[model samples]
Target: MPGKDSKEGKNKNQILADLAMADARRMIQAWTPPVWDEGRRPRISLLRAKKAVPSADGTDLVDWSREERNLGWDMYDKNFFADVVDIEGHHYEVFKFEFIEDISNKMKKALDDLEWVALDG
Candidate 1:
C-alpha cells in the first residue's frame, strides 16, 4: 500500500494485497475442521444466491464469491484468477499468483502420480 501513490507503487499495493489474502486463508483453514472429501463440487457464488455452499475441501465458498463481487473483475486489469481461502472464520479471494510456486509443486506431484500426461523431457 505504501507504493499505491504511483504506478510502481500501485503494483506493490496489488502484491501486498495478494500476500495478505493468502495469509488470511491459511489462518482460516488451520482452525476449521478438516474436510475429507474435498471434491464436494462446490457452487459458484455468482450463480447461486443466499445459500452458503461447501467446497470440496468443506470450506464455506459463499464468502469467497461475495468478496469477488465486492472487488469486481475490473479491479485487477481483468487478468487474474480468484481463489477461496479461509482466514479467521472468513473466506476470501486469494490470487493464484500468491502461491504459484507452492501450487506448481503440488500439481507436479499429482500429475506424476496420475501419469496424467508425459512431462516435457
Candidate 2:
C-alpha cells in the first residue's frame, strides 16, 4: 500500500508534468517558422526520448558540458537523448519519455494531436 506522502508526491510530479506540457504547447503554437521562399516553410522536428527516469532533486538534469541556457521552457521529463527542434533547426532535448508516459491519458492525446502541428510547419 502507498502512504499519504507518496500519493502527494506523485500528485506534485503530475502537476509539474502538466505544466511543462502546457508550456511546450504554447511555445509550439506561438512559434513562427523562419521565412522561406514563396510557398515554402521550414520543417520543424519533434523528437522524444526512448526512456526517462524521474529525479527528485534534478541532479540528473544538469549537463555539465552543455552551455546550459534556458530555451524559455522546461522539459520536466528529464529526457536527454532525444531533441525537439524549432523551425530554425535548433535542437532541444527537453522532455524524458518516462515522465511523459506518466502523464494522464487525456494529456497524452493532446500531445498526439500536436504532432500534426509539428509536421504542418
Candidate 3:
C-alpha cells in the first residue's frame, strides 16, 4: 500500500477519491464522525430520488422534468473503473450521495478509504 500513502504520485481516481473524502471530512467538521476506511471498498449502488414538488392537478410529478436524480457511492477504483450520472438531455450534472445515514459510521471501515473518488457529472 506504499502508493496509498504517497498520494502525490497516484492516478486520477486515487487523487480524486482523496479529495472527495477530504471534502466530506471538512464539510462534516465534527470532532467525531466517520473517518475514511481503507478495508472494505464500497460498491457503487445506483440511487434515484424523484423530485417531489407537486404540479397542477396534484398528480405525481411530471416526466417533462423527469424529476429523476442519479447518485452512487463515491470511491477509488484502481482495479476497475466506475461512474454513474443523471442524463436527462445534452445538459447533465454529476450526483453526489451521502453514505446511507444509518450505515455511514459502521460502514466506514467496510469501505476502501485508501482509494480516491469521483463522478463525471
Candidate 4:
C-alpha cells in the first residue's frame, strides 16, 4: 500500500496533467493554416496528446526529437495515409498524399512556433 504522501503526489501529478492538456487544447483550437483549404485540411481534433520527456542532456529542456517522433506515431495511428475519393468517381491518391504531407509539415511548424508540449482528447 502506498503512503499518504505518495497518494497526494499522484493526485497532484494528475491535476498538473489536466491543466497542461487544457492549455494544449486551447492552443490547437486557436491554430489556423495560412491558406485554409477545407477539403484538404486535417482534422485537428484527431491529433493526440503526447507526454513530455526530459532532454538528452539531462536538462529541463524538452527532447524535441522525441516529441516529433511522438507526433509521427500519433499521425501514423490516425491513418494519415488513408485513401480518399472524389464525388465524381475520380481517385486521386497523389492529391491526398500531398495534402497529408503538407498538413504534417504545417503541424510541425505549429508545434515549433507554439511550443506546444501536448495535445488534448
Q: Which 10-residue window in model 4 sums to the lowest lDDT?
A: 85-94
lDDT of 4 by residue, 63-102 (tens): 2333453344344344442222211111122225535665
Better of 1 and 4 by TM-score: 4
RMSD value for candidate 1: 16.4
Residues 1-121 of candidate 3 have per-residue lDDT tens digits of 4545453455565556658767865775564424446644444533233333233445322233343233112222332213332222121112324434423433343333323342322
Clashing pairs in 4: none
The TM-scores, one per candidate, come to 0.23, 0.26, 0.21, 0.24
- Model 1 worst lDDT run, 10 consecutive residues: 41-50
Residue 8 displacement (Å), model 1:
12
Give one digit per residue, the lDDT tens place, for model 1 in 1-121.
6535544444564556557878877896676443335434222212112233334445343345454533343353342222222222122222246545544555455445435333331
| Sort by TM-score, top down from the best | 2, 4, 1, 3
For model 1, name the residue pairs that clash. Answer: 3-9, 25-86, 28-86, 28-87, 38-56, 40-56
Better of 2 and 4 by lDDT: 2
- Model 4's alpha-carbon lDDT is 0.40
RMSD over all Cα atoms, model 3: 19.9
Q: Which ten residues in a row have the lowest lDDT in candidate 2?
A: 85-94
Runs in model 2 lying further than 4 Å from the true structure: 1-10, 35-47, 51-121
The residue pairs in collision within model 3 are: 16-117, 17-116, 17-117, 37-113, 38-113, 40-110, 40-111, 40-112, 41-112, 94-121
